[model samples]
Target chain A: MFKNVAVVGATGAVGQIVRRLLEERNFPAEKFRFLASARSAGTKLTFKGEEHTIEELTKDCFAGSDLVIASTPDDIAQEYLPSAVEAGCKVIDESGYWRMKEGVALVIPEVNPQDALDAKGIIASPNCSTTQMVLALKPLHDAAKVKRVIVSTYQATSGAGVQGTADLFDGSKAFLSGEKYEYKAFTHPIAFNCIPQIGGEKADGYTSEELKMLYETRKILGDDSILVNPTAVRVPVANCHSESITVETERPISPQEARELFEAFPGIQVIDDLPNSAYPLPSTCDGSDLVYIGRIRKDISNPNGLSFWCVSDNLRKGAATNAVQIGELLAKNL
Target chain B: MFKNVAVVGATGAVGQIVRRLLEERNFPAEKFRFLASARSAGTKLTFKGEEHTIEELTKDCFAGSDLVIASTPDDIAQEYLPSAVEAGCKVIDESGYWRMKEGVALVIPEVNPQDALDAKGIIASPNCSTTQMVLALKPLHDAAKVKRVIVSTYQATSGAGVQGTADLFDGSKAFLSGEKYEYKAFTHPIAFNCIPQIGGEKADGYTSEELKMLYETRKILGDDSILVNPTAVRVPVANCHSESITVETERPISPQEARELFEAFPGIQVIDDLPNSAYPLPSTCDGSDLVYIGRIRKDISNPNGLSFWCVSDNLRKGAATNAVQIGELLAKNL
Candidate 1:
């Protein structure tokens, strides 16, 4: 198994989690390196109670590393990915930049582990909201073959990075204290508010996040014909992204059958009993790796539609955990 | 001119806003009576710097009132609506309790001002999120004749009640300060996350909030086969609700034409200049009565699909301003 691993952008929230999860999973690490921008370089991060200094990342940062996991911005990934591949190290990207690129495998290990084996030294992780959603949808898709997907995402601030999460806190404090507001990370003050647009709006009235859901799902599932309509919004939450998914399948599957398939998935936990106030919640899955799902039933208005509620810690299944899982798959295969 | 008005549940968020908006708009309120639950009776609320004592909302609270605005919970409204009606007062309901009842006219002034004249003493306000969305969609619907609507709402906590907004603040504070979590206002920790299912799940997997959007929109728009698929979500925002709306019109309408229609509407503002960052933002519209709209464009994949983003203060256009607007309509009709 490959052992030497380097984490690019290791100083940010997602990068921190990637480092922590690596240690927690006891992945065989021969040489561990933490990489970040120049400002974050020389900073020490404690993993499993051991302190490791972060190094400045450059085009040649991936040298001497068997595997590199990048949890950085899209611009940075687009800039440095070629260098990592040239260095002969396998790379797993956590940004949306490489997700749609041809021949760059988009891998969600729980759903499509086989795709990881075809990676030409670079694998792409999907948008955090898309990751948790597809994980929950895969089981249903396997059972009934989802034909149409209409999803509305309630995303957390952490999905935007540390600055976004911090802005929520600062902006909220400003609102509560009755002070002048300042906008930084978000277009509006997100404390006790919702922004309907998550990513920048494209020409077609869809935000980039919405388009990412459409394109990434098609690429990951290996089917372009799957109809997807997504509306992505940023909520004040810090960690979890929840989706209200309305799906139509090729074949009619009862809610009971869908529930059985979800319960059988390795990374999925069905918390759908509503009578006793049982359903997946953000707090319940805050630090966990599983996608918490509930509220599964038939969409009565449509012939074969099914509606379900899904929640997952965006920083985990949406980012770090999925990246780490990809590394594990790479180790097993290569 | 509504010179005499009684506000039931006057101490609640919506009730308070209704009172202030009446004063701000100078609605010729010669006398105003504030009514609240027995627990909150005798409390004082200041409007335009004048202190008004809240009275216990007995059945006789609406006596001699020209207009009575009911902003209480569904059960409270059901218990007291008859009293308001028997007192010879024209009633405007903020809650959805009477909205879809056999003869109660659901009215949005911009969309269905004529529906107000048909009211038999009671004019019902549409649900908050539904009201804002329909207000934004109405002009477009009239010009293009919308055949189907798919909406996913990013609703604020204030839509639930005062306690709901408070719970978000308290819970977010708790989680941020590293305390154990508990959920009182919502089934999930909404401080740093999003919950897909709001207002509980119905037997058909659609949430109660979702159903309200579907049914209320059809009723207000005077169309039943409009085919609305709604998924309502509760976000951490305090007072504004945002919606991503996709409308399939009977015929194709260009994005430019759609923008012209939205801008021509009395209460709708078009903020579609994406490059300049000029879009409807919740924080900016926190105290405004207008429904701010932006991100308008055609759905590339669907020839007839037109998509847009809409935001409004749920407390205003969604609830209070709508109720007060209905009160204005009632007085004109009376």
Candidate 2:
């Protein structure tokens, strides 16, 4: 009745989140293996009331596992996950390594479910920022095909991994006490400031995070023609990732129609009323699985343009919850 | 050898900064009067080694004063400052109430000194955000006429005044402990998140801060034909404000030429170097008066578009320093 499961990079933020989602959803697994690098191995992690030791993430770690969730860094996920496929294990990859692959399906289950079927032993989860953007955009995109997306993100420190969160707290202390901050996780200080450049800088002046929104959205939506311009920024927020998005649609739609469409979506919440101050705030959306959408209105500058604010728990909907949903889809459809 | 000076709202954030600037620059004032409301009268403050007793601001407070700097709230500045003008004091108002007035000149001394002379006894300082923006844009607008501007700001807590900064700290503590945050200065928690709306919402969906950028740029640049659209966000930063500005110019200008123009301008430092990660950060410009400009590049999307990042100490260059510079110009010329 249960499938054998394995988790790669079991010690990471995303990996721990993946484990939490699996436990919370009561995903039936015959056996669970926690795999990490040799250096990270042998640590005891409690999952679903059982304490299991982390094993070295060698090629053999995926030998008998029916499903493998790789929440590791991109390079390791890319290099090692193909071995899992060779061992006949399906992979729900939470890294961008396999996202643009020729055969692998880049899936956001709510947005694109049918593509999950054509998965050649692997499914790619979109970037944390992209996942939330698409979730917010899909409802509106369905009402009217989004032609161009101009987005500016106020992302959290956690997206840079656990050490990034620590850097914010530590850096702020160092700054307040008149001491120099030795940068570790981020390229600069994360506390008491906002960094406009996120991810590595591209030669074309777009950051890697910005390009991921463009590339991942195109791949997931199955629409390469859609234009996306993104500027990802690292704010001091801890969990939720917020975006100020302006979209140009193929046809004009009123704010009422837009609100209706958003409210109709499964994982979207419409919080657009300004008079009552009932807009979505990240502080309110912390730990929530649903993608919170608000500030819906027509962009007065352009004929068919719409502007809105979007927020979601990056660790949940953006990472673990999405991966778990992919597993649920795999359990039913695969 | 010195003029008698009066400071309205002498206990507020901008008021404190203006006082510090006056002392730092050794502003030539033989007599100084600190004026506040009836409730705040009798409070004493020290400036330039002299203690000044705060006086209740009444109809006659402006009498015998040569120059009065009004840093009060908008409605108060509007209603009270006209009385100051009637009482024969030449006023430099730092409130938005008189900034866009028909005859009142919005002055940022480094960029538009000639505009200051046109003031009809009430010289209005530009909005703090607008002050830094036009300072960076003027050098570019001079070389190439800017037709349009699209900016997204990562503003700081200081922009909302002292209470705003306190709210951020208190809200952050409440947020981490899982308690209901008391929203004082903002409608939501400002600890780890960004708010897309700043300065109250306007009729057309743009915030008051956004509209100020639009109108003030047109006034300061002396060009009503310029089209400006801005989205202002209050990020979790403490001191400086950063803006991602995209400009559409009438003519094409290379990134290098734009860099040279900015470098030649006073109170601007160009820090564009992508390969080495040497761009302006708020920490780098925290205590400085310079408008730190970086990441100057050509916009690949539009036909004569240029993109750059502008960072400045909102309290200094954006408020106090600019006011002091205007006072210097008034002293020299008027």
Candidate 3:
């Protein structure tokens, strides 16, 4: 296909993962270029047995690239994305900026690869919180049709990027050594505590992260009628994000059916066996691209309601891995 | 009006707090006795400037006591609680064994103190997860009548008692020091994880800990018609439990009105200033009997649905302090 690939924000935490995954997955990029901010530019990252310099991410960086995987913040994605598209580059963005915008596909390759194939310019990847959620919801909704989702996320600090994961270690060391530390990566201390807000407030008092789950789920799942109520809280963990989800289906879906549906789904591994003490935990699920699902049961409150717990490495399946998977799907047809 | 009070399982984590709260809250105990299993019988604990020997718990241990506070595991409480009540002692139990038993008042004194006074022999304190949840639900349920509740808990390891807390410290130190650590306090490693299952599996694939939240909330709120769905998770924390709650009321409850209701209710302090990053965290709410709530907002899915975050010291409001409050209530009626 002779596809030339460029990665923006290629020196960030997610960018490093993308760089590693490109070689690990043997991504079909004939030519590769890395771009980051001015501070990270001129740094070296190796890909496919060749060293590549991280160029400054500017308007002109995407001139020869056929596909650009953007892992920058939302504002940066918005600022430079149009230029990438104008330069004839198809962007798979890892930001919340263009997710809900008109005509842009919010894609999870495992759940909806077809959406990515149909996108015209930029295909937006779901948020880290949203990616793992919709992946779990996809199989369940396919069979019984999900009516409502009441989810509470036990998200990790790594979702905040490199600084968030670094602060977790630094804050813990400061506390364990009896010195004082205030976490700058998060709004509150993240060493041994939980914070309730992920981003600034949005409409209806939901944080931007919470709203991303609601909106992105509908867009990626292609079901706007599905009602979602999400509470996203940041825990002290460094990697995998966990969610306790209660879903109401249009028809009854038992625990057995839910388990079977999840097991059959791609990018999902079921680790559910209660008696022998087997279930999903964020710590154990770290470093995996697959979202782990367990604690499958029926919600006692509603007859058609099902409850389950899911975990995924926020850096892998939540962001870089999924972004790479989308690039794979896009590259095949290029 | 002299009160002869006895505390059972006195050497355990919750039992130690029960002893301290008794003195710190100046519970009008004229003569105090400490009792535990035979291994801890001779150990001594101080109360009100007096040292008391721990007596071995037996059929005859409660003979001279007016009130007994039980803070043991389910099996231990089951083995000896009936004997304590039969021996003419009014007992406030902190174990899950008697919570849903017929006619055993599952009491949270701040929410339903009158239920304590109506007890025939023993009053059961709700589960730590249920304790913090109902406290937040009561005020909103009072003003708008909560019809359906969806709660996810970020419970602390201390809720597992001494061994659970010790494992958190041991596991973290082992991880930091690069030594292999196996966590016995939880089913998985508690160093940097979240375990979804608390107790063993029960009916319909739900864990015993999760069912406790469903059943206890109904009993404490005195409304079995209200639908409750809960996912109980144990986080890598030492003390205090937190909950992310989504409540559906009969009528819409605005964020402002919900805040005022929580503030007006006793044993609840509203800390919901989002602009300044004000919300409940397990770290800050330690050592208090009050349930701290914040992140109060209306749910986007349902007009009548309200969402909030709550935290409480599991040892205090969740167990010892709540049990003591019930004792104080029982004493006044006597």
Candidate 4:
């Protein structure tokens, strides 16, 4: 176990969840540190029945900490994480910054625990949307060698940040009351509508978020030949991210076989029962660490295709739980 | 011009829009009559600056009307539409019952106006979800024969009828106030939630709505060979249905070629400019008759695949407007 484990961005949305998860899961460490930006420094927070003051994050802050798990914006991770790695701390990052960088391990603990054990630098967790999808695809990929994926995501506002949920609730109240609301988290009013664009434009008209689904899956699954076409849209749901995923494999996997594969896989729960209105929904899957799969059926368009719906709490399985799980995996290996 | 045009289900959601569209478009008819079920039989509705009493819809109501445009539940259409056909009136149905009937001609005016013109019996308007997608696919199919389509829909509550929107608004209000809400139109909560199921279970685990996207597209486009895989989902939007659609054609169609094709297609408007965060959104596409297309890009999964985002007013182009356009088409031919 690490002598001193530091939680970066401890007061932010995913940060709070990470703190709660680490506490709830009883993370093994000799010492715990909570660090945030200067603005949140000196604030009081409770962890494991004790009150602790938040510390301001800096280049020299990682001196004593042996393990660092960070959840910050891209630029913040880019600037501060390397310092932690150089300071001899084993780092796991939640930001998108280091995931695609060469030698920076992108680990979903259940999908690839060995990668975390072998990582030399900051290990990165996949994006909220990408994490749930890749976790669902992992079993299918192992069974049938998934060749292509067509996914359209119904992402929750929480993926944007805490302010995204604030915008959704407040904007919805304003819409109901016929009042104008100035949204802070999204350019479009996300109260009762769908925003087709998630991240900024990347090459070939794909958003940065969409490309991550493609590139991250390739990296995590360690299969560069697998093709992915993703359209990530933000829906009004407050927590879990859901996906309508169709997978084409080297061989066709029937719905029954897919159900078995999903049930046997770790971190996945199958909730498919269409005739009775049973399926994995955002409302049902919120706050859960497990990825839920439902609506499993044959992809009528292709002979080698199978389709299903996937949902997982973006903040948990997609972000915090994933990061904490990585931390636990490392602790086990240590 | 018809001596008398009868509008059916004139008090419901799509019925109200059909009334407004007829007035706005100044449909050529010497006289107009409104018909509804016995519950709303004597209700007063104004059309073209004239107050008309709603007549009870019955087997004998087709007597003086030379043309009939209907937007009613499937059972009502199943029972009454054949009678209108027998009464020597040109009938247009917005219900799903007659759409897949052997003699029925499923039509989208922009895509298949000739089918509407050639129909000897009730002309059927496609499902709201199917209409928007097929309209978007028509141009691509024309340019390069579309072989398979995979579409996931972000359908709005209004497509569930007036009560659906009522549930959304009232449920959202209740959710904000921390009160319990009993949903009327959906099996699950639709406020700030996404329901993966749209219609009742049909064969092969596909919902009736999903099968419509497949069967209806085949009928409307007059191609039984075109393969379609659809996942229809209901979102919190009050108006307009959006879809993430990927099409694999017989030949490769570049994004530039697809955009040009979409721009030239009737009833399609291109709004793609990702760098500027410009794309088709449900909030922006509401209350429009034309289908909006954006996020046009290459489907990285397939060599011959092209993908796009489509949004259209489900009440207008999906139902009322398409039915009214069919009436206009038959009138012009006469």
Candidate 5:
């Protein structure tokens, strides 16, 4: 069994959560190691009451490790993942670099654990926005094949890392105090506003974040024929990301059936009581890992359409918890 | 013409903007009077550097007024608009109560000023969320004949009035200071979160605000065949409302042609240059009466589709400015 585990980028936001989940979930890691960039090499992080020093990640960092989990940027992950895989350590990466690559499995454990089991060297978790969306769509797609998805995201600040949350607080305070401060984390002031762009421009005028949702959803759900139209906007919330999703299916599915399917699915919770004002909002859904689905109703314009609201902690279900879940699934066969 | 102008609800948020625009636009009003609720009856507002005492809005307040421009609550507008119209006063109302009524012409001066000119007694302006949308759609629909629209709105807190803005500022300050405060302006916390429901529940699971976008769009555009599907979400912005819009037209309209159409149309500005990140954001579009459209692209999922982003100051262009423009139109005929 793979008992020796190492977490790359150990001191980062998603990395801290991964470490915490490993301890909280009591994964069978007999020995644990931490790795990060040279600047953070000597930093100490607590795991199960013991302080572990983060080492500068190098090719030899994964020599004795049986499994490696990375929550690094695209360039860092791309640079270090091959070395870890070559050292006979199984790898799970939380970066956009390798997700679209051939021979790599983009796994959302609740939707597709089989992809993780069939991984070749490196398994990838889908982007933060894509993970929650596919989790909500998988069961419904099985009942009625999804044809098109029109989504507008109200993403929180934490998706940009800890710096994003800081920028939100600092920018908001700047506006309130009548002080001028340049927005550092995002392209514009994220306080009291919504920016329509999340990532740099990509193919055909879509941002990289929008493209991630487009293609990663297809890969994770194992359906390439699904058409996804995404408009990703950044809101000022600290943690959870909310989506207004309108789905058109090849077969008709009523809102009741869709609600039941979401409720019965794993890692999904239905909070859709309108009379109680119980639809998912970031204030209520933050700090949790479940994908909260609510406000389900049929689109009156299209016969095969159903629309709903979804929210989930981008740091948890969207990133770390999903990566940790994949680690759990991979551990079963090890 | 329109020499005696009375602005009802003068001490309120939208009413303040209406008073400002009336003065700034140099409307042909020789005598100006301000009217508000009984509580604000003794307050004063300025018009063209002249102070006017706000009187209590009563049935007889409009007796000598040639044009009554009102920005009051729904019930207040319902109670007073009829009396104003019966007292030899032409009225332009910024309330949702009479907007969808059988004979009340819902006017966006840019889209349907003719409807304002042919008004029976009281002309109605569409909801703030609907007004910006129909302004962006009218020029395009005149070119390609719109068939269906799917939109998600990022509305500002000012749409809820001054108390809503207070809640946002106070709620955000509380959340930042580690204090718990319940949201009063909205059902959920609007400090950093987005609330999906805008108004009370209405027909077929849509909020009243959503239904306003549905019926008001068709009414203002004078095309009852056009279908609109809207998801109205209140964001943290204090002034501007943003929208992610996808339109399916009878014939395909390229992004270039749509940009040209919007550029040529009055009361609309095209801020779409992806390379420069010059799209319309709330921070830049606030306090302006023009509807700003950007991020225009062809929706690859459907052959006859185009998608874009829109932002407008909900207070200026959507409500008060629109009402004032109708008053200007009424002045022309008087």
Candidate 6:
């Protein structure tokens, strides 16, 4: 077991969830440390039936901790994570910064745990949207080679962090009362509306978030040949992210076969009953750590294509739960 | 000009818009009559600044009217539209019943005006979701033959009728107040949530609304070979419908060429400036009559595939406006 485990960005949204999950799962660790930025430092937070003050994060803060799990913004991860690795700590990052860097493993424990077990540097979790989709595609790609994917995401406000959910609730109240609200988290009003663009523009007219869905899927699945066309949009839902996904494979996977494949896979639950109005919904799937699949059917457009709806709590399976699961996998290997 | 024109279903959501559009466009009709179901028959509505009492819709109501434009439910259209045809009235319907009927011509004026002009019986307007997508696809398909389409819709509650919007508002209010509210129009809560299924279940696990995107596109474009895969979802927006559409064509249509084609196509406006976050949004496209296209980019999965984001007022271009435009076309041909 690790002598000490440090949780970075402990006061942030995903960080808070990570703290809870570590406690709930009774994670194997000798000592726990909570760290955050200077602005959030000195804040008192309860971790495991005891009060702990959040320590200010710095480049030299990782010397004693043998394991570091961070959930900070990109710049913070970029600046501080390398210090942890140099300090001889097993670092797992939950930021967008280090995932695509050469020699850094992007790990989804269910999809590719061996990469995490073999990593020498900071291990990275994927973007929230990419994590859920890659987990769903893992079983399919293993059974029948997934050639191409067309995905349109209905992402929730919480994916934007704590301020995003705040904006959604506050802006919604103002909209219902006919008052103008100045949004802080999004450029446009997300209450009772949809925003087609998620992250800032990247190359080829795709947003940075859309491109991540493509690049991250390739990295995690270790198949650079898989092509992904993604359109990421923000919806008003407060928690879970949902996607309408269509995949074309080397061979046709019937709905019946797809259902069995999903059920047999780890970290996925199939909830597809159309006659009774059953499917994976954001409200129903919120707070869960499993990727939920529903509306599984044949894509009538292509002979080898299959279409389905996927939903997962962006904070849990998509972020905090995923990071904690990675910590558990590493601990088990040790 | 037609001597007499009758507006059926003149009190509901789309009906009100049809009334306003006719007045706003200064339709060339010598006389106007408003008709509705028995529940709304005695209601008073103003047309061109004059108060008109709604007459009860019946088979005998078409005696003097030379033209009829209808926006009613399927059963009403299924029962009454044939009567108007038999009464020698040039009928235009905005219901789903007659749209796919053998003798009826499903029309989108910008895409298939000639179909409206050539119809011997009831000329039908396509579904709102189908209308905007077909219009956007028309320009691309003309330049390169569209072989397949995969569309995911973010439909507004207004498409569910007045009750749907009410449920959204009231349910949102209740949800914000932490109160339990029963939904009226949808099986699940649509307040800040998405329901993947729009219409009732049809064959092959596709909803009726999803199949319409497939069947309606084939009929309106006069091409039965074009394949479509659609996932229709209802969002919390109050007015417009948004769609994420990807099309694979016979040849590659570059983003620049697609933009030029969309700019030249009537009823389509391009708003794709991602750097400034200027894509078409439901909040911005709520009242517009034209279909708005944005986020035009290459489908990285297929060399021949192109993707775009589309938004339009479901009540206007999707229903009332299309029906009124069809009436104007037939009036001119007279």
Each prediction's Cα RMSD?
Answer: 3.0, 2.5, 1.7, 0.8, 1.1, 0.8
TM-score of 4: 0.99
Looking at model 2, the pairs that clash are A237-B192
True contacts kept of 5: 0.53
Model 2 chain B weakest 10-residue run by lDDT? B169-178
Model 4 chain B, poorest ten-residue lDDT window?
B42-51
Q: Residue B154, candidate 2: how far off, in angstroms?
A: 1.8
- Evaluated at residue B178, the lDDT of candidate 6 is 99
Which residues of candidate 3, in runs, are more than 4 Å off? none
Instruction: Judging by lDDT against the true structure, name the best candidate.
Output: 6
| Clash count (model 3, backbone only) | 0
Off by over 4 Å in 2: A28-31, A173-183, B28-31, B173-183
Which residue pairs show backbone clashes in model 1? A192-B237, A192-B238, A193-B237, A237-B192, A237-B193, A238-B192
Which segments of candidate 6 are over 4 A away from where they belong? Answer: none
Specify the CAPRI tier of model 5.
medium
Give lDDT tens digits, candidate 3, residues B91-115. Answer: 8899888989898999998799888
Relative to the unseen true structure, what is the C-alpha lDDT of residue B327 in candidate 3, on a scale of 0 to 100? 85
Give the fraction of reference interface contacts each candidate recovers.
0.50, 0.36, 0.65, 0.90, 0.53, 0.84
Superposition TM-score, candidate 1 onto the true structure: 0.91
Which candidate has the highest DockQ of all?
Answer: 4
Assign candidate 4 its CAPRI class. high
Clash totals, every prediction? 6, 1, 0, 0, 0, 0
Q: Please identify model 4 stretches exceeding 4 Å from their true place.
A: none
Could you give the CAPRI-style class of model 2? Answer: acceptable
Model 5 reaches what TM-score against the true structure? 0.99
Docking class of 1: acceptable
The residue-by-residue lDDT of candidate 1 on B257-317, one tens digit each, is 9888887889988887765656776767788889988878776546887878899998898
Give lDDT tens digits, candidate 6, residues A1-334. 7789999999899999999999999999988999999998998988788889889999999989999999999999999999999999999999999999999999999999999999999899999999999999999999999999999999999999999999999999999999999999999999999999999999999999999999999999999999999999999999999999999999999999999999999999999999999999999998899999999999998889999999999999999999999999999999
Q: Measured by TM-score, how close is model 3 to the native structure?
A: 0.97
Chain A of model 3, TM-score against the native?
0.98
lDDT, candidate 3, residue B163?
88
lDDT per residue (tens digit) for residues A1-334 in model 2? 2378888887898888888888888886777889999998998999989899999998777877889888988999878999999999888999878888889999999999888867777888999999999988887778889887778788988888899888877776666557888869888788787787887787577778888999899998888878777778788887789888878799987778888888888888877766566677777888888998877777755668787889999988999889888888888864
